[model samples]
Target: MAKGDDLDPKGLIEESYKIEGISTAECRSIFLDWALSYQGVSAVGIAALLARHGLGTDHHPMTITLREGLLAPHAPKRRGGRRGRVVD
Candidate 1:
């Protein structure tokens, strides 16, 4: 994972926000791609990066969706079940 200055040299996040009429779903996809590419960066870090680049998610619906998607808690997996049945 790239750090500090190396985070997004390609400016993908900026481009995503520049697209006219882009939807929240599209932003989510773009955000996912961006996040996945930066292995060491946390979601909060990404948000801060976007903000520093003038694409803050706070006022934008699409960006807000991306932020929420990144920060949303993961669902817990069930430990022993095929539809909750015991394996014995």
Candidate 2:
């Protein structure tokens, strides 16, 4: 096993989300996608996170991650230059 596999799970999950090319929104999205990508969180585990978020099994959906919430309008804006900063 990799050195990190033995780490505390919360720390490992946080570290995995920090790996290069893994953005916060992608991490949030993959929390759902994770169901398919690997052995994945247990059905019980998925149920727990969903319940913690007040998501009903029947209809609630994942909200945008913090970064996505901040950046959505910028999806159409040009990259680079000084306009990047949100003005007061």
Candidate 3:
């Protein structure tokens, strides 16, 4: 459960912050990769990473993405399809 390896094993989040004028879309793509790479990381862990990496830049794309990820629902949302939309 090391911070560096566990939270952001690929260092995508860290690198995204380093890119000057990075776009929200790019951050989102990097975030998705980070999330899929390190599944099951708790919200608290994410908060720590945010605190460490997101320091004073509220407008930072990575910071915004991380905050959004935190706010996102834990349960997977059902997609739009007859089978998916049908209530059991």
Candidate 4:
């Protein structure tokens, strides 16, 4: 895999790949950290990170997490709650 880039400033994604038999949940946590640490837009960062890593159906947890992140919705939907009912 390519060296950690600005998208993964903490090297969380790179280290996640090194972890053998890492669970998807763990990867998700790492991805969250990576996402929070990254300054640029997530889609752009994720795409660049994937390209740098040269991943293709490797079934690696990090790969799965990155792909899932891409597929995930951009806008977070509000679940039914008091906050959801609040209005200006």
TM for every model, in the order presented, reads 0.61, 0.25, 0.72, 0.73
lDDT of 2 by residue, 1-88 (tens): 2332222233333344336655555556655344444353354544444444433322222322422323335457566767766665
* Best candidate, lDDT: 4
C-alpha lDDT of all candidate models, in order: 0.64, 0.41, 0.81, 0.81
Question: What does the lDDT read for residue 66 in candidate 3?
Answer: 86
TM-score of 2: 0.25
For model 3, how does the per-residue alpha-carbon lDDT over 17-88 read when each residue is reduced to its tens digit? 779999999999988877777766558667977988988988998899889989968897677889887878
Show how many residue pairs clash in every candidate, following the order shown.
0, 0, 0, 0
Quantify how close model 1 is to the true structure by its C-alpha RMSD in Å. 4.7
Identify the leading candidate in terms of TM-score: 4
How much RMSD separates candidate 4 from the native structure? Answer: 3.9
lDDT-wise, the better of 2 and 4 is: 4
lDDT of 1 by residue, 1-88 (tens): 2223456555666676667877777777767776677656566656666566544446664567655756669899877758568556
Clashes by residue pair, model 1: none
- Candidate achieving higher lDDT, 2 or 3: 3
Put the candidates in lDDT order, highest first. 4, 3, 1, 2
Candidate 4 local lDDT, residue 17: 73
TM-score-superior candidate, 1 or 3: 3
